[model samples]
Target: MSFFSRMPLFVLLIGVAGLAMLVPAAYAAATAWYEIARSFLFSSVLMLVLTALLGAATAGGRRPGPHGRSVLATMLGVLGVLPIALGLPLAMVLPDTGIFNAWWEMVSCLTTTGASLYAADMLAPPIHLWRALVGWLGGLFILVSAVAVLSPMKVGGFEILSSPYGRSERFRPLPESADPRNQPQFFLGLGADRTTPSARAMRVLRDVGPYYAGLTLALWVILLLAGDPGLVALCRALGTLSTSGISPVAGSVGVHSGVLGEVVVAFFMIFALTRRFWPGGGELRATETLRTDPELRLGLTVVVLVALVLFLRHFFTSFEQEIAASNVATGVLISLRNAAVAAWGGFFNALSFLTTTGWNSVDWQGARSWSGLESPGLLLAGLAIMGGGVATTAGGVKLLRVYALARQSERELERVVHPTSVSGGGRMARRLRSEGAYLAFIFFMLFALSIAVTVLLVSIRPIEFDTAVILSVSALTNTGPLAGTIHLTPSFESTAGFASNPWEGWSGLAALPKTVLAGAMIVGRLETLAILALVTPDFWRR
Candidate 1:
C-alpha cells in the first residue's frame, strides 16, 4: 500500500492538507506576495512536522484506533489546531489585526462559514486565494466526513434513519487491526454499533471521494469557460460544490456571471441541497429515482412557489411606473421581460439561501434596481432556516428532517380529522410517521433552543435585538454572511444617524460577542443534539 493509503484516514488527511498548503505558498512567491507566502510556509512546515511526530510516535506500537476518540480528536483538532497555525502568518502580515481576529477569519473559513472580516479588495491576492482555498478544503472535509463519520453514526440528519426506541448496533471488533498487547478499539453508533471508525470512514471516502472531486472539477471548467476570472472561477467552483460560497470577487456568481453562467451555477447549486444529485449518493427508499428525491422535490417546489410570489409582487408593485414610460405594446413587452428577470432572480436567490450558500442574486436589491425589486429579508431568512439536504455540505435544518417532521405532523392531523383513516405506506412507514417524526421534531426544538440561547447571550452585550436574532440564525444555519450584510431594515441609515451595515452590527461588537457567534457556528456545524448525545452514557453503553 502507498504511504498515504496505509496511514489512518485522519492522519492521512493532516499530512495531505499540510502538503496542499505548499501550492499556495509557491503561487504567492511567483506573484511577489511574499508576506502571505511566508505565512503559508510556516503553516505547512508546522503541519508536516506535527504529522511526522505523530507518525513516528505510533510506529512499532498499536496504531491509534479510529473510535470515538479518533473522531472527536480529529474533528476538534482540525477546528482548533489548523486555525492557530494558519492565523500566525495572518497576524504577522495584517498589523492592525490582533490574533483573535485572524483566528476568527480562518475559523469562519474552516467551518465553511465564509464570513469575511476583510473584504476581498482589501486583502492581498495570496490571502484571498488562501481564504478561498481553506473554505474549499473545509467544504470537502465536511462532505467526506458527512457520509463517513456522521451518517454511519446516525447523527446529523441521519438520525431520522434510526428506528425510534431501537437498540444500538453491536459488532465484533475488527481482528486485523487488533494487537495481543493492546486493548481492542470499537466504534459505536448511537452507543449500539461496533466497527472501526477509521476503516469505515476511509471506505466511505474512497467510495465517494473521486466522484465528488470530478463533479467539482467539471464545475470549475464550465465556470472558467463562462468568463469568470481564474481565481474567482476556482473559488466559485469549490464554493459551489462545498456550498461554502467563498469567492475571489465580491458580490456572488450572479454579479459576475453572464446570463449563461448564472444558469450553469444555479444547476450546480442543486447538488448542494440534494445528495441524490451526486454519484453513489444517498438512497432513501422513498426516493426511487431522481425525480422522487424528497429534498429535490421540496426544494424545487419552494423555489418556484417563492419565485412566483416574488415575481408577482415585483410586477404588480411596479405596474404604474412601467406603464407610464412606453407605448402600450412596448410596455407589455418590457413588462414581460422584467417579470422573467425577476422570476429568475427570485428562484436563484431562494435556492441559494436555502442551501446556505449566502449569494445574493444580481437583482437582490435593497432598493428597486434596474432588474427587479428587493425581496423580503424575512423570506431569505426563512429559506436559510429550511436548509439543504442531509449529508450534503449545505447547512441549515436539513430538508430531510424537515420533511420527516412535516409528514409526522400531517399524519397526526389526519388521525384527528378522520378516526377510521388507515395510515398508508407500510409498517415501517407508519412507524416513521410516529417515531421518526418525533425524532426530527426533537432536533427542531433543540435547534430553536440553541438560537434562543445564543440570542439571549449575545444581546446582553448591547447588540440590538434584530441584530442579535440575525446573528444567532446566521451562525446556527452555517450561513455566517447572512448577518455580514443586509438590505432589509428599511435602509442602511442606523437610528444613531450613521450609515451602517449588518456586518457593522456584529463586527463592531466586542470580542466576547463575536466569540459567542463563533461558538454558535460550531454548534450549528456539529448539530446540537448530536453533540449532547455524544457525551451521554446512552451513546457509549451500547
Candidate 2:
C-alpha cells in the first residue's frame, strides 16, 4: 500500500477525535462554561472543515493495508497532529500567547507527557478539563495502536510484548502457497486453521482490549463512588488506566484530597504497572511469567527499596511540617500507613508515568520530605527512565531493555572468567546478546537525548536546573510529577517560578527551540526509534 493513500484516513480519524470535543463542549455550554464551549465549538468546526476537504480530495485513491512504514508514519503523524489541532482551541481560549507555547501545552497533554506551561491552580476549570480529556484520548490512542499497529511491525520495543514463555501457547503455521506475491492468499489460507499465527495475533488484541476497557470502567465507578464529580471521575478513570496524568485540576490524585480517593487511585496505578496481574486469557499467567521475568522483579525490587527509604525518612525527619503543609495528618500508626500509602503511590506513579500514562494524585508540596530520604524522588525519576513492559502504553528506557543489558553484562563477566563455559539462558537470551544490545543501546541513547533536549528547553524559562530536569524527565517520559516540585499553597505561577513575566523567557527563544520541544514530546511518547524509522527514507523504500 502506498503511504499517500493512507493520509485521508489519518486525517479523518484525527477529525473524528477532534469532533469528540463537542460532547464536553455541550456539557460546558449547558453549565454556562462559555469560554470552554466556545473553544470546543470553534476547534471542532475548523477540524471538521479541514478533514472533510482532505478526505474528499483523497477519498477515491487506493486503500492501503497495514504495512510497517505506513503504520509508523500514521502513529507518529497522529502524535504530532493531535496536539497541533487541539492547541488551536487552547490558544484561542487561553490568554494571548504565542502559538508555540500553546502547542507546547497541548503536546504535553495529548502525548500524556504531563509537562504543563501553566500552574494547576491558575488554569480555569474548563481548560483543565480539556487537558485531562486530551491526555485520556492520547493514552487510548496509543494503547490501541500498540496492539493493532506496533505489535505486528515489531518496533518500539513491542517485540517484548510477544515474549515466548516456557508454557507459552504454540500455534499452527500458515499453509504454503506457490506464488511469492500472494501474501494475502497465504493469510487467507490460515483462516481455515483455527490455531493459525494470524488468528493468534488477532486474538491477542481481542483479549487485551476488553481487559483494558474493563479495568478502566471499574476505576471510573470507583472514582465516582469516592466523591469525584462525574466529569472529573470519567477523566481520571480514562487517564489513570491509560497512564495519562492529565488531570481536571493540577494536583492529580491529590486533587480529590481524600484518603479513600488517594488509596483507590494508588491501588489502580499499581494495577496498571503490573502487566502480569492484568486479566487476560492465555495458557501463560502474568504472575507465573513474572516469576522468571527479571525486569518485573527488578522494578518491584526498586519499589520496595524506595518505600523503605521514604518510611525511615518520615519516621525520623521533621515529618509534621511537611505533612502539615499538605494538610495531611497521621498518628504513629496512621503515619506508618501514610508512609506505605505514599511509597506505593510514588512507586505506582513512577511505574504508570514511565509507561507514559502520567497519572498522579500525590501532593507535590510534600516532595521535599521525600527528598530528605536520600532523594527517593530522584529514584522514582530513575525508574521513569527505566520504564515499564513492552507494548504497554508507558515510556522511558523500558525495564525489559534494562534487564537485557544486565543479562548481557552477566554473560560478559562469565566469558571473562572462563571464556568457554556455555551461558545458561535460552535462545531469547542469545538473541538479546546479539540484536537486543544494539536496540537497547539505541533506546537509552534516545532516552538520554530526549531528557537533554527537554532540560535545555525548560531551562530557557526561569526555573531551577533540578526542577527543570524533573519536569523535562516527567514530560519526556510522559510521567506527571517531578518529585518534590509540586507546590499547591501558592498558585502554580509562583511555585513554577513563572509569575512575574513567563513570556519574557520566550523573547530569548527562537521558533526552532519551541518546535524542537514539541517534536521531542511527540518522539518521547512514540519512542525515538519509531520516529526515526517513520522519517527515514529507507523505511519507505519497501
Best by lDDT: 1
Q: What would the per-residue lDDT of candidate 1 be over residues 33-131, giving only the tens digit for each residue?
A: 887788788878877998888676665556544355466666666665667666666676676767787777778787777776665666777777777
- Lowest summed lDDT window (length 10), candidate 1: 491-500
Give TM-scores for every candidate, taking all chains together and pairing residue i with residue i: 0.87, 0.75
Task: Please give the distance, in angstroms, between residue 281's alpha carbon in candidate 1 and its true position after superposition.
Answer: 6.4
Ten contiguous residues minimizing lDDT sum, candidate 2: 186-195
User: Whole-model lDDT, candidate 2?
Assistant: 0.60
- Per-candidate Cα RMSD to the true structure, in Å, reads 6.3, 7.2
